[model samples]
Target: MALHPALTPVADLVGTWRGPGRGEYPTITSFTYTEEVTFTDVGKPFLTYLQRTWSPAGDPMHTETGFFRVAGGEAVEFVLAQPTGQTELAEGSLVTEPRGFATELHSRVVNAASAKIVDATIRRLRLDGDELTTEFAMAAVGLPMTHHLGSVLTRTA
Candidate 1:
């Protein structure tokens, strides 16, 4: 099927990517995991996103599902939900580079009563050819915004 015109800017992300990633937070020990991320086009203006991570021993660590859309010009948005009882609305801009694109997103977080307290988050992602690099900062659980995770992944499908 032909790609939606609105999704042209992020067309490169419409595939499965897998690789290693490291995560850390002020409240927990640092650890490494294997991560897989997939972006699928459902014949709509937005792309469906799914991400999952597993520990080195293959235990499931984290997962999230979301929708990504280009909201005209360089503006983009991502609405996501996590099993941890948190939902996030992120808005950002996408800048086209010679190799690919770079995005900087800021998110407003809402947590369920039973969920951990998460106030806000910032994420930066750069896609160059088949490599995807990402960094995230978060404010939560009495901690101010601080680096939380980073990963470099390669297209797997």
Candidate 2:
């Protein structure tokens, strides 16, 4: 199927990417991992998103599934669910750059009773050619919003 008009702004993201990433939080020890992210378009207005991370020894660390939507013009939305029992609804703007695009999304998080206290999160993604860089900040576990994860990934497909 041909790409939807609304997805043109983000068409470059419809592939798999992998690289190393770093994670740090006030409540946990800092660490590094291998991360893989994939974006898929099923001929729909939104792109299906999936991400996974693993330790150097190949132990799975984190995973999330989501949908990325370009809601007409520069408006964008992301809906995500994590195995950690957290759901996120994020909204932000997508700005087209000379090389690619940059997006900053702020999310309201809902956590299950058994989950840790995660109140909000902010994610910024930038795409330039085959390089994708992302940074994430979170307000959780009695800590203020601070940088939590950053990664630079190369297109693998």
Candidate 3:
């Protein structure tokens, strides 16, 4: 099938990207990982998005499969599901500048294992000719935490 019209603008992200990433909460840790994101269109209004994250230490931390849709001009919604017992229904609007595209996503993570919910806000920035960066601010387990998950990812494929 062909790509969705709304997702065509994000076609650049449909590949493998690698870089060092940091996760911060009460503590900070660094790791190297390769992120594989694929976008598929099924003749729908939205794009089917799948992301696999892997580290040198193991296979993959998580995989996200979802649909990307647009509304209110530049606003976007990402509904994702994971096999590790989690799902996120996030919504955000795009902030496009001369440099890149910035999306501020507000979501809630439902932990299917513990029946816990976490409120999260993520800012994902993608520069025109640079790597992608995502900063996450979350209130998980009744604790406020802010960190960088994918500090930067260089295109590897």
Candidate 4:
């Protein structure tokens, strides 16, 4: 299918990426996981996003499904839902670079009554050639905003 014209700034992300990731936070011990993130275009104005992670022992760790949309000009929007009982609406700017593009998205979260408290989150995604680097920061569980996870994934599809 043809790429959406508005997605020109982020066309490079339409593929599957897999790599190892390190996760850390103030409330928990640091850990490492292997992650796979995929972006797909289905003849629409937005790209479908899916991410999953697994432990070294092959245990399922985390997963999120979302949609990525370019909201005119350099603005971008991301809406995602997690099984952990939180949904987020994140918005940010998309900047074009020599290699690809980078985005810094800040999210407003809605948590289910049974979910843990999550104050805020910032997600950063950078594309350089065939490599995509992802970082996540959050303010949650009575702690201030802090670095939570990071990974460098390579395009595989």
Question: Which has the greatest lDDT?
Answer: 4
Query: In candidate 2, which residue ranges exceed 4 Å CA deviation?
Result: none
Provide the lowest-lDDT 10-residue window in model 1: 68-77
1-157: candidate 1 lDDT, tens digit per residue: 8889999888998999999999999799999999999999998999999999999999999999999999895998999999999999999999998888999999999999999999999988899999999888999998999999999999999
For all predicted structures, in order, the TM-scores are 0.98, 0.98, 0.76, 0.98
Error of 4 at 82 (Å): 0.2
lDDT of 2: 0.95
> What RMSD does model 4 have?
0.7
Clashes of each: 0, 0, 0, 0
Query: What stretches of model 1 exceed 4 Å from their correct place?
Result: none
Per-residue lDDT over 20-102 for candidate 4, one digit per residue giving the tens place of the 0 to 100 score: 99999988999999999999998888999999999999999999999999988599999999999999999999999999999
lDDT by residue for model 2 (1-157), tens: 9988999999999999999999998778999999999999999899999999999999999999999999976988999999999999999999998778999999999999999999999999999999999999999998999999999999999
Candidates ranked, most accurate by lDDT first: 4, 2, 1, 3
Ranking 2 against 3 by lDDT, winner: 2
**The CA-based lDDT of model 4 is what?**
0.96
The residue-level lDDT of candidate 2 at 154 comes to 98
Which ten contiguous residues of candidate 4 have the minimum total lDDT?
1-10
Model 2 is weakest, by summed lDDT over 10 consecutive residues, at: 69-78
Which residue pairs does candidate 2 place in steric collision?
A: none
